[model samples]
Target: MAWGESGELFAINGDDLLTLSLEDQTVETRASDLKKDSPQHLPFSGANILFDIAVGPDGTAFVAYYGNRQLLAVSPAGVVSVLVQSESPWSPHGVDVWGDYVYFLESTVGGRPRWKFWGKDRIAPRVRRVSVGTSTLETIYDGL
Candidate 1:
């Protein structure tokens, strides 16, 4: 769960992105199933297992999609987009947004069936960040 600067609380339940208005005390589903941003018509892969959520200053919600290893962005109007993608065994684990970038964590599943483990997939853990405005990806400490 995360609180947006616009006074809305954002959360992910299953495949549904929910937004709760603190003022009016109303809850709304921003996006569901995340089908709009899916890669293909996958049977098992299409199921989105949302992990963490972060709301930007402009009310855009960033989510860590664990199932298919994707970081998604949901607009204030509930439009969804696949912001960043990771390869198999390496899934997006955590997410947060600050000023000009959306911070995220990508970790390996290590062949876990139910997305249970966070072991390295024979790869060293690295650090990176994506710029919000220009959408440029800058690597900080990529095993360098």
Candidate 2:
């Protein structure tokens, strides 16, 4: 979960994004069924999980999807759009914003069963940083 600029907290559940208002102690849907809402007509089929969220300074939400290898944005107005997506096996997880960049982690071993048993040398996980507006991705670290 991540907190917005206005102090609203956002979270991803299954394939849905929800908001919690601390003042009112209420929960509401920010975006529903990401598969249907994903950009480029790429419907999120199967048990695709909406993994993590990062709320921008303007109250927009950035979400990471492990199965889809995608990063998505939810405007404060609740418009959902894909910020980044790939056909490769770059399974993205754990997202957050720092200044002008959105940072996330990736593991090639992801989406595979019993990945925990895989050798570290075989599974090269990475940390990536990207521009929020331009979506220019950079690999900051790999493995360990």
Give the best candidate by TM-score. Answer: 2
Off by over 4 Å in 1: 35-48, 110-124, 142-144
- Writing each residue's lDDT as its tens digit, candidate 1 over 1-144 gives 999888888887766999999899999999988634664422144445677898888888998876766788999888888888765545665788867998887664333343333344243344556888988876565431
Evaluated against the true structure, the overall lDDT of model 2 is 0.75
Q: For model 2, where is the 10-residue window of minimal lDDT?
A: 38-47
What tens digits encode model 2's per-residue C-alpha lDDT throughout 1-144? 988888898877766789999999999998888754444423234426677888889888988877678888898878988777744556677789999998887766444342463354244477888898788988898664
Cα lDDT for residue 102, candidate 2: 89
The models' CA-based lDDT, in order, is: 0.72, 0.75
Count of steric clashes across candidates, in order: 0, 1
CA displacement after TM-score superposition, residue 99 of candidate 2 (Å): 0.3
